[model samples]
Target: MDISQESGLVWTEVDLSGVFDLDVDESLELESVGDGRVLAVSASPDVVNNVLVTDNGVDWAALPIPNGFSPWSVDITGERWLILGRDPTKEAPGTQILFSDDRGSNWTELAVELGPFDGTAWIGNAIVAGRLIVAAVQSDTWQPQLDEALDDDMAYEPSEKHVHLFLSDGGPAELVAEFQGWYTGGHGASDGFHLIISGPAAEDYLLHSPDGRQWSSTIVDVHVTDSARNELWTADPTDGRFKLERFEGVFGSDQVLTLPDGIGWMPDLAVGPAGVAAVGGPASPNDELGGDFTLPDISIEKNGYELRYNQPEGGITLWDLNEDSAVYVFDAETLQSEGEFQGVSEVEDASGSNVVFHDPETGAELVAFSGEELAAAVTEEVSAAYSEYDPDEFIIGWSTDGTDWEWQTPQEAFGLPESTPDDNSFTQVQVAVGHDFVIAMVQTYEFLGSDFGEDAPIGVGDSQSDSTSAYLTTTTSPSPPRWFVARVE
Candidate 1:
C-alpha cells in the first residue's frame, strides 16, 4: 500500500481486498490489542457466522461463534475481547456479552440482563478503566420501519429513560450505574482512564471513572477525548461563537483559552492531547452510505464535531491548542481555486495533531500548523476523477481543524487497491479515524468469488432469429452478507 506523511501523522493502507473467502455482509469493527495484534468482529445476526482474528492483514484465522446470539458490537478491554450481541428472543428482549481471551478461539458468556429492556436495545460497548470494564446499554425510541405502516398516534419520540451501565471481569456481568436518560456517547477508556459517558440530560450526569471500583461524579458535557482528561466548550448566548476551556480533571483546575468564535459547540465537542483544532467546525457533513445529516436548525455542538458551513470568504478561523501556540487561517481558497470544491466530504481528526479531508474533486489533503516552525501539508491531484460508484478508491485528505479540506494522495500509493483493474461499483462502505489508525468497514451485497460454480445458467435459443449471435451471462446469487475490516496505519 502507498504511504503518505506530514508531521507526526503517517497514512498507510492495509489490503483486505479479497482477504475473506466469504462476502462480508454484516457490521464490522476492528480493535487493536496492542503488540500489533488486531481483532476483527463480523457482528452478524446468524449464529453460523465465524469470528475472525488477525495478527497482520496478510494472514487471518476464524473462530467459532460459540452460540446462537447475533453480535451487535465488539470492544477490547485490557487483554480480553468483549463481544456483545442479542439473543434470539424478540419479545422479552435479551442481550449476550462474551469475553474472549485466546484471540476469540473460546468465549465466556455473561448471564446478566437489564431485565425488560424495551424500545431500542444495544449492548456490549465496553471500556476498560482500571479493574472496571463498563459496558453501556443504550436504547432509543422505537420508530418502526417507514415502509411498515404505523398507528396514527404512534409515538416517534425515544422512550429511553436511562442508560444501563454494567461491570464485568471476564465472568458474570454486574449491574453498575444506570445513568438517567439514554447513553448518547461513550469513549472507550480514553487515556486508559476515565470512561466518559454522556446523554443522561443537560444538568445530565457526566458519569466518569478514573478507577473502576471507585468513581466520581461530575457535570461538564463536552466531547469525549482520551488525549485530554476533560475539555469545556462554552459559547456566548448572544453570539454563536465558542471557545475551548480545557483542564486536568479531578483537581477541577482548567485554562480558559479565549478563542475567536463563529461555530457553536455540538454537545459532543471533544479535544485530544495537543488540542489544536480547526475549532470552527467542518463545512460539509456525511453519514453512513445512504445517510445524510438531519439537523440544520439544531447545532453542531449537539451532533459532535461535524462542521456545517464554511465562511463565504473561503476560509475559517483556526487555532493551535499546544504549549507554544500560533494561529493561522484554515484555508480552502487554494483548493477552491482548483474547482467548485463541492464542500468538504470526508473528514478525519486523526490522532490530535492533524485533520484529514477528502473531496471527490479535491482528493485527500493533510494540514497541520503547530507554529510557523512546525507547519506541514500534503495534497493529492485535485481532479473530479472517478465519480464512478466506488468506495474503496476513496481519497485520503486532512485538515488541522475539521473545516477546510486539503487533499492528499490515495491508498493505491500504499498498495490497497481492491483488485488489479480499478476500484468502482461496490458502494456500501464507511471509514472513521481513530487514535493511531483509520478503521474502514465494507458491507458486501453480491457474493465475492467465494462460492464458485454454484449458479446454473439457462441458455435460450431463438428459433426464428436471424443468423447472428448468442450471449453468455453470469449472475451472483445473494448469500447471507457479512462485513470485513481494514486498519490503516
Candidate 2:
C-alpha cells in the first residue's frame, strides 16, 4: 500500500506480532506521547494487562501497570502519565485515577471524591491542560426491581445519573463543578486556552473552562468534537444534514462543509497543521438499493435487499463494503475542499503536525501520512519555547495568544475500525502518529482460520462471551483477516 503519493513516503512494517502473547481477539490501544514516544496498552481479561512504551517505533519496553488497577484509558503530558481505571481491590471501587511523573516508573493514586452514588462512577474523559489536569466524571446508579407479577425476575434500571468536572494540579483532584444530569457525557476537549465539556442532556449543553477551575455553561445546538488553538470543531446536524462547523467562541461559528448526498453523517474529524479532514460514509438509509440512486459508469439492481459496490471517482474507488465511506479534506484556514479519498475508515493527526489516513480496502491496508510544510510549522512553534522550558515537561506549551502551543494529538479516535473483525475478517486498522514515526496497527485474522478448526475455540478464556464456540459454528472465512504494524518515518 502506498504510504503517501505526494511525499513518496512508504510504510516500514514493524514486527510487533510477538511483542505480547495475546489472543487474536484481545483489545489493543495506542497513544502517541510527545517526543517520539508511543504507549501501547494490551487489555486482557482479569486485568492481566500490559503497558508497553516505545521511544522509537522499532523498540518497545514494558511498563508496570499499577496494582489491581485495570486501566480504562491513559493520558500523557510532558513526563506525567495519568491512568484512569478501576481498582477492584477497593472496598467500593468505581473509578480510580493514577498519576505517574517519571514515565510510568512509579505511580500515585489521585484521591477523587465523586460525591456519593450507589452505582458506579466512571471517568469519561481526562486531559492535561498546562499544569492542571482536567477530567469529566460520570456516575450512574441503577435500582434493582423484583417484579412479583413476573415471578420475581430481577431487573436493573437506571435510577440516577450525575456529571462532575474535576481539576487537579499534580495533587488530589478537586471537584470544581457538578450537575444533576449527565450533561458532560464524560466528554471534554482543550485547546490550551479553552477547555470544553459538552453532552446532550434535556438539551445540548457545553461547559467551558478557561483555566480548568473557572467554568461557564452554555447551551449549544451542535456537538463539539475536537479543539485546536482557539477554535472548536463540531458536527452540526441542525439543518437536517451533516455539516462540519468551526466555532471561534461560544456562539460564533462558520460552516466548514456539508457532506455530499447519499453519505451518512461525518464519523471522524482530525485537525492538524496541514488542515482539517472529515470522514463521511456508509451510504445513508435513503440511498439503499431500492432507491433510484445512480453513479457514473455503474449499474444498480433494483432489489429490496442492500447492495454494495465500488465506483471509481475523483482518483479513488469506494471501498468494497455493504456501505461506502470517504474522507473530505479542507484547508485549515480557507476551509475549502483540499480533496477527498474513498475507502478511508478514519483520519488522525500525528504529533509533529502530520495527518494520517488509513484505507483498509487493499488486502495490505494503505496509510497516508502527509504534510511536510505543517511539520515545519510545528517545529518553528516549538523552537520558540523558553530556553528553560523542558519539552518533556508538558504536552502543550504556553504562548501569548494561545496559538503558539503544541498538543499531544489524541492517542486513539473513539468508535474507530468501523468494520468489525471476525475469524476470517481482516478489516481492522488503528494508526498512531508520533513526532518522528507513525505506527499503524493492522489486525489480520488469516492465522485464526488455520489455527482453529471449525470446532476449536478461539477466544477461550475471555469472560465476555463464548466467542470461540460462536465463531466456530457461525463464522465462515471469506478471507481471513491479517494483523501487523506499519511504522512510517
| Candidate 1 structure, TM-score to reference | 0.44
Residues 45-66 of candidate 1 have per-residue lDDT tens digits of 5625445655544456665666
Clashes of 2: 9
lDDT of the candidates, in the order given: 0.39, 0.44
Where model 2 places Cα greater than 4 Å from the true spot, the runs are 1-9, 34-36, 45-49, 88-93, 115-121, 141-144, 147-160, 183-202, 223-281, 285-426, 445-489
TM-score of 2: 0.50
Using TM-score, give the best candidate's number: 2
Q: Superposing every Cα of model 2 onto the true structure, what RMSD results? A: 20.3
